[model samples]
Target: MKTRKKILVACGTAIATSTVVARKIEEELEKRGIAVETTQCKASEVPSKAEGHDLIVATTFVSGAGDIPVIQTVSFLTGVGIEADIDRIISYIEGA
Candidate 1:
């Protein structure tokens, strides 16, 4: 496994929503024994901020993620499909 996986968590404002998402992702990844480094950003900034990151998890739609995998979800806020999202994240990390 990679030493650390870099993740970009994006939301409409990059503050409240992204922070929650980032925290959840960090906890989930850590439970799987994967070290994670996360950066929070606005959805509009994803194109630039997503560079060099392993994955993008956003509550809002993100465009121009380039080659990085983007998992668009509101599960972090709604408490639904959170497990599926985590599974997808793990898949991306393992595959990478």
Candidate 2:
């Protein structure tokens, strides 16, 4: 069996916005048969909370994520270019 992917979903507040992004990522990836675990954090917390995660998805600028792949976008909130973003994330999973 394949291991579940760990995704760190971050935004400015780490509350409402991050929740939305995390939930959407979980829902979308599950439909594609990809198991994922998402943890929400503030962008400022990213450097400290980013370890052990496979990927970082943020709605704002984030750094200190080390070598983990980071996808910075507002697509989830905007409802635009979402498919392309998801595809990009899927590509990372495939490569992993």
Candidate 3:
């Protein structure tokens, strides 16, 4: 069986918008039968929290440090460009 991909979703703040983004990604990935684990975190913790995850998704541009693949997108909450961006991220993870 294939292992589920773990993802870290982060923004400047964790409460307000990052939670929404994380939920959306979870829902979308589930619909495609891709099991994913999402953790909402502050942007500053992304580098540390991303360990062991398949991807790190940030709502804003992240600078410095992280070995895993990263997807920079703010649309996960706004619902704009979310589908396409998420699709690309998923494809990259799967293809890799």
lDDT of 1: 0.89
TM-score of each: 0.93, 0.96, 0.87
Instruction: Put down candidate 1 lDDT per residue, 1-96, tens digits, no spaces.
Output: 547878899999987999998998888778878778999999999888888998899898889999999999999889999889999998997787
lDDT over C-alpha atoms for residue 11 of model 2: 97
Candidate 3 lDDT over residue span 1-96, tens digit each: 887777878789888778888888888888888878788888888767777777788888775435777888878777789889878878866875
A best-first ranking of the candidates according to their TM-score comes to: 2, 1, 3
Model 1 residue 6 lDDT?
Answer: 87
lDDT by residue (22-92, candidate 2, tens digit) is 99888888898888889999999999999998899999999999999999999999999889999988998
Error of 3 at 91 (Å): 1.2
- The TM-score of candidate 1 is 0.93
RMSD, candidate 2, Å: 0.8
Q: Is candidate 1 or candidate 2 better by TM-score?
A: 2
Which parts of model 1 are misplaced by more than 4 Å? none
Winner on lDDT between 2 and 3 is 2
Instruction: Please list the residue runs of candidate 2 whose C-alpha ends up more than 4 Å from where it truly belongs after superposition.
Output: none
Error of 2 at 80 (Å): 0.4
> lDDT of all the models against the reference?
0.89, 0.92, 0.79
True-structure lDDT of candidate 3: 0.79
**Pairs of colliding residues, candidate 2:** none
